[model samples]
Target: MQNKAIDFKRQVNIKLADTKLQDALSRLQTRFVEGRSAVISEIHHLEDTRTAAAAIRDCVLNDLDSWLQKFEQQAIAHGAIVHWAETATDANRIVTEIAAQHNVLTAVKSKSMVSEECGLNDALEHAGIKVMETDLGEYILQLAHEAPSHIVAPVVHKNKEEISDLFAEKHQMSRKTGIAELCLEAREILRPAFLNADMGISGANFLIAETGSVLIVTNEGNGRLVTTLPRVHVAITGIEKVVPTLEDVTTLLRLLPRSATGQSITNYVSVLTGNKDAKAHDGPEHFHIILLDNGRSSLIGGEMQEMLRCIRCGACMNHCPVYQNIGGHAYGWVYPGPMGSILTPLLSGLKSSPDLPNASTFCGACAAVCPVKIPLPDLLRNLRTRQMALGLKSRQEVLMLKVWGWLTLHPRIYALATKIGVRILAMMGGERHLLHTLPGATGWTDGRDFPAPSGKTFREMYRKKSTK
Candidate 1:
């Protein structure tokens, strides 16, 4: 939320130098990437499903006002309260005020990225309310006082041994090496919080405007407990999460779990229509939904509107080469990877996160796997162009671009320049066939060696082949 993305490169270097991080990140490809590929391949019409899902999201965005109004009317009709928040501050204030009004002392929270975006935990704590993260990944982060590194896998950046140490230190329990043992230990500690909490806070996977229900999909049972066991329940999410109907929610559900965790469907999918009725056996007495704008309204009819279609499935980041090398924290905010590169700049301001757009390799791995088909590489490139227009780039970069542009305008000079440049690079490479870091230049070379040119222009090679 704070946007330390200004330290993007520094954070990247720190994460790269960390062997433990590298070891942990190595599994991301196998776990999320390959798993998604295998699971999605099972669908005979995955592309058609994706296109339809995208269309549903686009339909919502095209007439967001009418849909939101319909949603509000339907939700109130079902006896639920809906609140609009214009900014992060407004959102936080609304939640804390709700807690205060309910006389809530202890609150339990399920994993919600929008809450993180609004810095809700700190705000609630400052308001003198105790908060507990019920999701295992989020609970671990809460214990260690660390932020989530991945959207679905919040604690992906940490290893089991580190988590074991954290639990032992924080929970004052004996160290457990087995994953199951550790999970049970966490559950043991969190059970009391679930029973004692006066209010529950959660993130919505999809908001169905038709039935006025809040839907959440989870592998663990925490989501249900957090929303039902407490007397009061509050669901906070971006306005982009709304869909037109239950069928729309169902269409997106077909892709969310597969794209996120490679599951057929999450173990628990709960649809909360409203609070407890007079005849209902058990449920929260008061239910509220906070729709957060926080800079999303500006993208409705703009070049960046497609970004609003994201389902937070994280398929794009799972395949991102840059994120593979450096984990999400380097993006320096709640969202990370390809989507973070676009959304962080758009929401937080392009000036605050100048480096995020350029963090991509333009390889299109992200776009290929995107369930919604957001053209991520093109968006990142557009951000870079905006950087140029705003004069945010260094003079050296601008000068280099200008020189490169001028050279391409003169064919003979450009040809001669390439021929001479290749020979110089060849001489520098000598027998190694690779160029080491040039003096005073450790940009790319700092990480790895650059291959030297072949010392022959493409034109010369083509002419020789033609003669042959």
Candidate 2:
């Protein structure tokens, strides 16, 4: 993962400077914004649903242990083999063992973020299994040998032309310019992989404890096919995905799609109960469920426990200004955006991902749009504090912040520094009241001009007013 982080940062720096990537990201971001706005505008009870969803998630988190046990019992009764994986290694071993038992040479998979979290694809491929991604976005990324750039829209960073070029190169297909044509081409190429796969892997959207069912919501029909067509089906989910009942799952269903893609409901919503019975026409013969702990259990009683409430809706990322500017690869993980800022450090370890939590501007846009009400900015700050305690912050930044803190504590020094700074900026800007370039202000001035501070400090005016 550490190596992946470094590689991701390098890729993002290259991708950010590419004009094609910028244009693609801009168009994609705009579509999401407009679509979500349209949905919110039409839905009169959006906020109420968000509140109700948040409450449901909160209740599940509060009683996670009980719910997990109940879910396991129900799933076993429904003929699903339930496996508890307390670590990534455990999770990988469980999946690989299942695949080996079935002599699975090829596996067809839907987009499961939990699988990404566990590095399941690479693990299986390493064990000599062929893994094929069925999602169109995921397929594009797989061909490019890249991780997902966004949670919902995995290849949001790629333009159609880029995809056309990739397909022509990778699959020897003709250059297709139309979006629908490209999708059709991918579908045709993946259809064979699906029919030949010995195992199917998918991520659960929500796990219903009452009935021990795995719920998956997707726009493409591939998710349904992947789970039902193969001889063996495996569902990978995080511990946090468990809910008390189908009713609780309904509350999340109302908010997730609107926050995610501005749709009232995704095109396909599948509820799977264990394996197919003898009378069932079509379904997997064997069913397995891997519940991943992966450090999430530790967070249950900690300060950042609220983060477990995230539904992976990608709303926080969609609305975040930082994510809008830099995109997901900049955060360098399976998760990105505001939710990623908090989750990456907790799951990946704070010392390695110090830059992630500090990447936010704390503008609170993420929290405002989050349907589950995760306090992203606050959690990021908390992670930053923890990082500092661990001495993971750079020396220069620490010193700078300490000096700033000291000056702010001393009113006289702060006032004097502000006056001097204002006068210097005013002199530099002259009548324009703006600076295009300033020493020690390169980061701020690189893209946008900085407005010069007023000649007089607010403290001076306030002092005069008080005296009068």
Best by TM-score: 1
What is the C-alpha local distance difference test score of each model? Answer: 0.92, 0.87
Q: Look at candidate 2 and give me any clashing residue pairs.
A: none
Which ranges of candidate 1 are over 4 A from the true structure? 439-441
**397, model 1: CA deviation in Å?**
0.6
* Candidate 2 per-residue C-alpha lDDT over 227-339 given as tens digits, one digit per residue, 9 for 90 to 100: 98999999999999988878888878877888899898899989899899999888999999999999999899789999999999898888887778777787878898889
Predicted candidate 1 versus true structure: per-residue lDDT over 124-234, tens digit per residue: 999999999999999999988899999999999999999999989988878899999999998988999999999999999989999889999988899999998999999
Best by lDDT: 1
Query: What's every prediction's RMSD, in angstroms?
Result: 0.9, 1.9
Model 2's alpha-carbon lDDT is 0.87
Cα miss at 154, model 2 (Å)?
Answer: 0.3
lDDT of 1 at 158: 96
